[model samples]
Target: MDSRRSPLGRAALLLVALVALPAAAQGKKPKEGAYVPAPADQIPGYSAKVMPCEIIEELIPPRVNCEGELLEGKSLRELAILRNTIFARYGWAGFRKPWLRDHFQKQPWFKPNPKFTYKLLSDADRKNVHFIGVREQSFTERELRRMEDTIFARAGKVWNDVYEWKLKDGRTVRSCAEPQDPLDEKEGCTGANCEGTHSRDCFFREEKWYRPDPKFSEDKLSAEDRIDLGLISRSLGSFASDTGKLEKGAQASLDRVISVQELRQLSLRDLRLLRNTLYARRGRPFKSKILQAHFKAMSWYRQDPNYTDARLTENDKRNIALIRSVEDEFGGPLKDEDWLIDPATDAA
Candidate 1:
C-alpha cells in the first residue's frame, strides 16, 4: 500500500504535484535535497514520440539498511580517488556517481592519502612520472587458494564452451594395423577408404582423416557467457571481502600488478580493455602502453606460472596466450617529450 500517502490522501496529492512539476519549479539542486529531471527534448532535432522514455533514478534516494552500527564499515577514500582518476583519464562520462562513490568508499583497506596532492596534468608531463605507489590487499593462503580455484573453475567453462570438440574423421586414411590383417585389402584396410594402414611407418599417425564441421566452428558463447563470467568474478570478489583481502570494493580500483608477458596472452580485445583500464588508473593518456603491456605480458608468459606479481593468475596466463597471436602494429608507446604551451605566445 502506498505509504507516501497519508490516510487523508493529502500526501498522495503532494506526490503527484511534485512529479508533475517542471525542472524550474523543483527548487532543489543536486547535493541539496533532490535531483531535478533534465529535459528530454533539449537535444537537437528531438521529438517526444520518437524519443525513448528514461527514468531518472537519482530523483529517488536509495533506502539504507543498517544491520547494526553504521560505523562498522571500511573507509575507502583512496579507492574513490583511484576510481575517479580512471574515469577522468579515459574520457568516459555519465557514470552513476553515487554507485561509484559507494563502491570505492566501502572497501576494507581504502584510506585517504591526505599527504598526496591531486594533480591534473596538461599535454606536458606525460612521461616524466615514474613509480606510482599502488597498494594491493594482502590475501592469506586460504584466500589465495580460494581465488585460484574460482578462476580455474571460471576459465575451465570458457575453454570447454569455446574449444572442446574431437575431430570426426579420425587422424588419416589408415589401414588395419592389427596383426591378423597386417596390410591386406581383405582386412577392411584400404589406402583411400580405411584407416591409413599404408602409413604405419609414418612419423605421425595421420592415417585416420578427420572431417571438420563448419557448424562446430560457427558455435560461440553469447551474452549468457558474460553473465556466467561475471557471476564467477563476483563470487571471487565476495571471497576476497569475506577473508579481509580487499583494498577496495570497486572493480576498477584494485591495484593489481600484472606482468607484460601475462597481458600479451589475453585475447587482443581483452588485452586492450585491460590496458585501457590500467591507463585510466594511471591518470595518464593511452598511447603505446597497449603494446608495452602486451609485450610485457608475453615476456611473463614465457616463465613459470608461479611468478608473483599480484596480477598474473593462471587463468590470465591461459587467456593471454589465446590472444597473443594478434599483432599490435601501432606506434611505439608514449614519449616524455614536453611541448610547452607558452601563455604569452598565442599563434593559432
Candidate 2:
C-alpha cells in the first residue's frame, strides 16, 4: 500500500507542498533577505573557481590568479573590473573598498616599478591612472581636482630652484641651486693663480652664465606661473630647435612670454616682442602674416570660427589693423622701429 495515499501520509505531503511554495503564490508574501544565488556559470566567469581575480602584492609586472598560480597578462584595469564583479556577486562588499585603495596605491599603473615600468609611463603614471579613474567614474570631480593640485605642487617643487646656462660651445646645461656658488669654493681665485693661464677664470670666463634671480624664488610665483614654468621646461628643447640661427637668450625670453592665456591678451607691444624674439632665433624676418596666421590657429581663436573685424573690440581691431599694415609693407626685414611707428600716424 502506498504510504502517500494514506490519510496521514496525504496530510504530511500537503504540509510539505505548502511549505515549499512561494508564500505569495499561496496568498501570502515572502519576507525580505530571501535572496538565492544564481548558478555559478551565470556569473561572468566560465568557471567561478578559476575566475581572474587575484593580485600579488609588490610584483614587478602585475600578476593575476585565474586559477591555481599567479600569472602575468591582464592589465590592472581588467583585473579591477574582475575583482569588482567577483566581490559584488559574492556579497564581499566589505572587502571592495580597502582592496581598491590598496590596488590603486601599489599597482604598476598607479606607481611605476623601478625595473618593470615603461620609460614613457615613468613620469605619467599618476596622470594616466587619474584619467582612467575619472573615465571609469571611480573618482569624484573634487577628488580629481585635489589630485591635480597635488601633482602641480610636486612638479612646481622640482622646478623651483632650477637654472639653465648656455655655454660658448652652444650647449645648454641645467642645474638646481640653493644660494651656493655654482663652482666649488676650492676652485675660488687665489692671487697667485688669478691671472695664471690655469686659473678658474679660464674655465668659466668664456662661457655664458644664466641663473634665476635670487629674489624670485619658486614660492613667489603664482600657481599659474609655476604651471607655465613647468610647461616651458618640458618644451624648451623643442622650442629651441632652430638654436643655430637664434640669438643668445632668445629661447629663454620666449619661454617667459608664451602661455595660452597670455597669448590672447597680447598687446601690439607684446606681439612685437614675440616677433622680434622669433626673428632673432630664426635669423630671418618674422613677418606679420606669419604672426597673424599663428594667432588664428590658437585654440582661443578657433573657439569662434566666425571671428571678424565686426566682432572684434575696438582695441582688437586696432591691433589687427597694425599687424596687417606691417604685412602689407613687405619692406626689407622688419626692425624694432617698424613696430614703434604707429599705424594711425602712417595712415594720417
Candidate 3:
C-alpha cells in the first residue's frame, strides 16, 4: 500500500483493486458499522402498483414528519397513519390490517420482509416510537405554547396580529388583506373597511372562521376559559405585561384570586395539577410517578434544589389554598391518572 512503489508493485496493486470492485457491485456484505437498508426493489405480485416506502430512518422528525402539520396538530387518526407507516416500512404483515397494508402497498419502494424484529429498529425508530407514544399522553413544548395562544383566540380576543375583525355594523370582517380573487378589490372587504388593521378593506372570508370580537373582554370569557386560563397561568410564569412579551395567561391566578366557578370546571385530578404546577415552576420535583413523569414531559419544567413554598407568589399561595379547599370537599387529593394527560402549562 506504500505510495512509493515499483512498477511491478503498482501493477499488482491495480489487480487487487480490480478484484475488489466486482464483489462490492455483487452485493458483498459490508464490514461492521456499515449498514445500508436493503435496496427498495420490486417484489413481483407483492403489491398492486408499488412505489418506494416513503418512511426513511429519520430521527423523531419535526412534527414526527407528518407532512405540513405540526405534531400537536396531528389528529389521532393522523398519528395512526404515522405509526402504521413506520411498521409498513419494515415488515408489512401482509393481509393482516389490510387497510393499512393496502395504503402503502402501492409504493414501489416498499420492500416488506417478514423477518422484522425489535432488534432491527434503528435509534431513530426506537426514539420515534417512544416519543410518539409519550406524546400521545402528553403535550410537547410547542403544543403547549400553541394551546396558550389558542385559548385567547377561541374567545375572539385579538393580539397584535388580528386576521379577522368584527366590523362596527355587526358584520364580521377580515383585518384584511390576502384577497383570493383579483377581479374585484371588494371581494374580501365587501367594499367596506375596518379599523386599524394592516389591510384597509376587511372582507369576510367564506368560512368566516376567525371573526375577532370587538367586545371581547376578560369579564366576558366563558367559565371554561376562566378555568383553563387559570390552569395555564399556574403552569407558565405570568401574562403579557408592558414589556411587550406574550400577552397570555390567567389574571385570577396572577392577581391572587381563584373562583369556585373556575374550580368546578376541573376534575379532582386536574385540581391536583393546578395545585402542583406552582411547585413545579419553582423547580420542585414530585414524589408521585404520575406527576413526575407529567411535569418532566414539559420542556419548561426544571428541578430546583432551592425550591420551597416561600418561592411561590402571593397569587400562587392564594390559588393553591383555594384549590386545596375544593379538593378537600371532594374527599382530599386525587390519585393522578396518567389518563387525560393532555392539556399544557407555563408559569410566566
Candidate 4:
C-alpha cells in the first residue's frame, strides 16, 4: 500500500489548502469576523474601501453594565456615545433631532438598516441606557434642561436657557437676567459662569466637547424635545422654587480648600454666596443688604463689630481669594466695596 497516494492523504492535503488559502492571500490571519470591506466600486460612488456595519460596535469596547468607575469621569458626550452607539450598532440612526445621524453615518463601518427599532435593544442594552440616563441627571444641563438637553449639550449646541425663574410680577428672568427673545436676539453670556456660551473654557470644556453657536436657539431643538420638555414640566407641576438651591445645599467653602473643579459644578449664584460665606464666617460686616439678610438667617452668623480680615484663618483667606478669582473670571470684577460695607462708627 502506497500511503502517499491514499484517499485519506488527498483529503488531508485539500483540508490544509482550504485552511491556509485566506490567510496566505491576505498575508495575515483572518480577524474575528473576517468581515470583508467594500471596495471603491463596491459601494456606489465611493473610491475607498468601507467597513461593514457588522463591525461598528468593535470601534468602542463594550462595557459590563457601564457601572461605577467605568462611568466616573466620562463626559456627558461620552456617556451619550456609549449609550447611543449601542443603538447605532443596531442601526437605530438618530433621535427626531437628527443632530447625530450624520455622526454615525460618517463612520466607515456604518450601514443603516431600515429594520432598526428600539424593540431590537437587548436586556444588556436597556440596562446601559438606563444607567447612563440616571447618571446623566447629576449634570447641570440635565438637571436644568431636562432629558432632551442631554442630547444637545453633548453635541456642544447652545439653546436659549429654558430654565427661568418667574417673578412675583409678570416679569421672567433666566440666569438672573431677563430672558431674551429667541428671535432677533444676540447671543451672550448669561450666568456668572457664561452658562450661555459654548466657549472652550465652558464646563463641557473639560471633556473637549463644547462647540457653542452664538446664533443657536432653543427653538432649534426638535419638536420632540419640546414635547418632552412640556410633559416633564407638567409632571413636576411647577418650578416656582429655584432648582439652584438644591445644588448648593450647605456646600462647604470656609472649612477646606476648594478646587476649581468643584467650583465648576456650582452656578455663579452659588459662587457669590460661597465667597461671601467666607467673610460672613468671621463676623465681617456685610454692607450689601442682601448679604446682611443672608448672614442674619444663618444660626452660625454672629456679627462682630470688630471683625477684621486679620481674624481669618489662613485656609479661609486662600479659599476666599480662590472663590473670588473664579467669580471674577465668570462675572466681571465686582469690587468688594460693592458687596461688603464698612460698619458704622460713633464718637464716645
Candidate 5:
C-alpha cells in the first residue's frame, strides 16, 4: 500500500518510520579494528574526582618536568584504576593517537601536558603503582643494598648513644647523652642552691654522682670509662658481684642474694648470720637444692633448675660471658654493703 497517496495512509506511514529509526541504530555495531574511546564512566566502582596532573604524570614516567605544578588532589585509588585501564587498552600507542592525547591535554583543571616518564618517579612511587596492579620493574640489588644500609646506619646511630641506669630504689631509666652534658641536667637546674652553678653536686640531690649499670655497655662506649663517668646505678652495682658470680657457676657464689634495700633493713648481727649461712651452704647439694627452691619462689628467677651450665641455652651462655668480662674489671664480687655504708658517718 502506497501510504503517501492519502492523508490517513501518510500519517500511519510516518508513525512506523519514527518507531523503526531507534531499532535500526541499536542494531548497528562498531567496525572491527576501530579505536573506540572508553567512556568517562566506563571504570566501575570508581567515582572519585581525578586530577589531570596525576593522570599526565603517571602517563609520562620518564621525565620530571611536572614538579611543583602538579595539583595536590585526592582520589589516588581512582587515578590508579584509570592509569592501568589506559595502559592495558592502548599501550604506548594510545599516546600517539591525537584524539586520546588531546582528551587528556584539554583538561581545564591542570596546566598543559608536563613532560614526564616512568623513570621520573621515585622507588616509593614505583612501589605504590605496582601495588595498584601495575607491573613495574624490580629494584636492583644495588638499590636494595642502599636502602638497607640507610636503615642500618640510622639504627646504629640511635643505639650508639643510648645508655640505661639502674637506680638504688630499684628503678631503671634510659638516656641518650653526649660527653659535654653526660648527666642531662635541666637548663636552669633544680633543688637547693642550684641557680648559679650547673655543677653535678648542686643538681644531683640523691648522691655525689650516679653511675649507669655495666649491662649498658652494649653501646659504643667502653664499660670502664662509662662506669668512671658516674653512670653506675648503686642497686645494680651492689648486685653486680653476686649476679656475675652466679652466671659463671662459681662454687663460692650463692644462687640468691639479698637486695640492697633488704640488706639495709637488716641488723648487723642478721647480716653476719646471713653471710655465714651462705658460706656454709656453699658447694652443698642439699643446700643448693633448698636455695634453688627458695629462688624459684622469687619473681626474677627465670632459669629452670634442670638447666645447668652444660645445658645452658645460647642466650644464657652469652650473658655469662658478658658478666664474666665485667666482673674481671672489679677484681671480685661487688657486694651491696660496700656502696651502702655512709662513708661520712663511718669516718666519724
Candidate 6:
C-alpha cells in the first residue's frame, strides 16, 4: 500500500478540517522574540536546533606569492674568491695567522709627525730622512733591516720608498714607509695608509687574517658552513635559555622551527618529547633525514644491544616511515649526512 495519501483524498480531508476548525486559530502566526531553545517535549525527533546549510564556492585560494630569499650578489663572488684563495694557499688554518700572532705591534720611536714638511727633496736629502712607524717613533736600521728588506723585496717596485738608511754614531735609522712616487711626490704605490692611483687595486690581504665572528651574522650560518655540515638549514640560535631540558611552555616558542606539516606527520608531543631520540638519532632537525636515521637505528637495534632491550617494534618503524613519506611529499629540506648522523659513530 502507498504510505502517502492521494492528492484528492488529502484535499477532501483538508476542506473538511477547514470547514470545522476555527478561523482565528488557523490564521495566527508564532510571535518573534528572544527565547531559549525549544524544550525536549516541544520538539519531535532530534531536539538540537540545526542551522540551515550555507553554500560556499568549492574553489581554493591561490598559493602564497612569497618569493624565496635571494643570496647577495657580491657576497657570492666574494665567497668564491675566498674559497679559491684558501684552496690555493693550504686551508683556512694556514690562511688565518698574522693577527693571531701579533695584533698591533708598533715601532717604539715611530714618528707621528715630521720635523719639516718638504714639497721636494734632493736625492741626498731624501736618503737621510725616514719614517720608522706610526706615532712619530724611530727605529734603527740594524734593529729591523732584515725584516724590512724581506717586505721590500717581495713587493718589488711597490716598495721603492721603503728603506732603512744608516745614521752617524753607529745608530741605524729606518724609514719603514711605503714607496712614494718620485715624480709626483705622492705616497707609496702600496703600503700602510698610502693611497694614490695604484692604491685602489691593492687588496686588504693582511686584514683577512683577523678573526671573524663565529656566530652567523644573517642566516645564522654561512653558506660554506651549511654546505660543509650538510645542514639543509642553520639553527636560529642555541637552545640555551632552557639549559639541559626545555623549560615549561618553551614548546610553543620552538614551533617556528618545526613546520605544521612536520608536526602533523610526526607524533611528537612537545619539544622535550624529541630530546634523546630525535637529537641522538637524527642529530640536527632536518625535515626528512629522520627517516634514514630511523632506518639506520632500526638496523642497529635488530642486532645485539637494541634487540636485548625488546622496546623496538614494527609500529614504530611504520610511524617513522609515514613521517618520512609525508615529509617527502611536502618537499621540506632534509639534513645532509654530516648533520643528521654523527661522523664519529656513523661514519660509514
Q: Which candidate's TM-score is highest?
A: 3
Per-residue CA lDDT of model 5 for 1-348, tens digit only, reads 001123343334334433432211256554564333334365342222322222222321211122343312212223323343333222222232232344345443222212212222223322233233211111222332233223223223222223443434544444322223223344332322234323222122223333323343224433332221111111111122211221223322234443444333222212322442332332212233323332233233345434334543354344334443333322222222321211100000
Each prediction's TM-score against the native?
0.18, 0.18, 0.37, 0.26, 0.16, 0.16
Mind giving the per-residue lDDT tens digits that candidate 4 earns over 75-172?
A: 44454445455555545543322334544677676666555433343344444444443443233322333343454564456555434444445454
Tens digit of per-residue lDDT, candidate 1, span 1-348: 001122234323323422342333345343444322223233222122311212222221111222332211212223223324322232222223333334434543333332211122221211111100011111222333344333333333211212111223332233223232233433433343345322222212232432222343212333333323332232222211211122334443234444444333222223334433332333333245322332232211232344343444454444333333221321111121100111000000
- Model 3 C-alpha lDDT per residue in residues 46-124, reported as the tens digit of each score: 2212112223223222122333333456533344345444445555444222234455667665666655333343334
lDDT of 3 at 4: 25
Q: 115-194, model 6: which lDDT tens digit per residue?
A: 11121122221111111000001112221223322222233313333333333343333345433422232333233333
For each candidate, the alpha-carbon lDDT, in order, equals 0.27, 0.31, 0.46, 0.43, 0.28, 0.24
**lDDT score of model 1?**
0.27
Model 1 lDDT at residue 181 = 25
Q: What is the C-alpha local distance difference test score of candidate 2?
A: 0.31
TM-score: model 4 vs. ground truth: 0.26
Q: In candidate 2, what are the lDDT values of residues 1-348, reduced to their tens digit?
A: 001133343344434432343333346543565433234456552133322334332332222233432223332234344433322332222221233434334432232222211111111222222222222222222333334333334333222323443334544444322222333232432322224323222222233552223354345445433333332221221122111122235234443323333332222333343443333333332235423332322222232333333543454444334543443332222233322221101110
- Model 2 poorest 10 in a row by lDDT: 339-348
Steric collisions counted per model: 31, 1, 20, 1, 16, 14
Q: Which stretches of candidate 4 lie over 4 Å from their true place?
A: 1-253, 333-348
Rank the models by lDDT, top first. 3, 4, 2, 5, 1, 6
Against the true structure, candidate 1 reaches a TM-score of: 0.18
Superposition TM-score, candidate 6 onto the true structure: 0.16
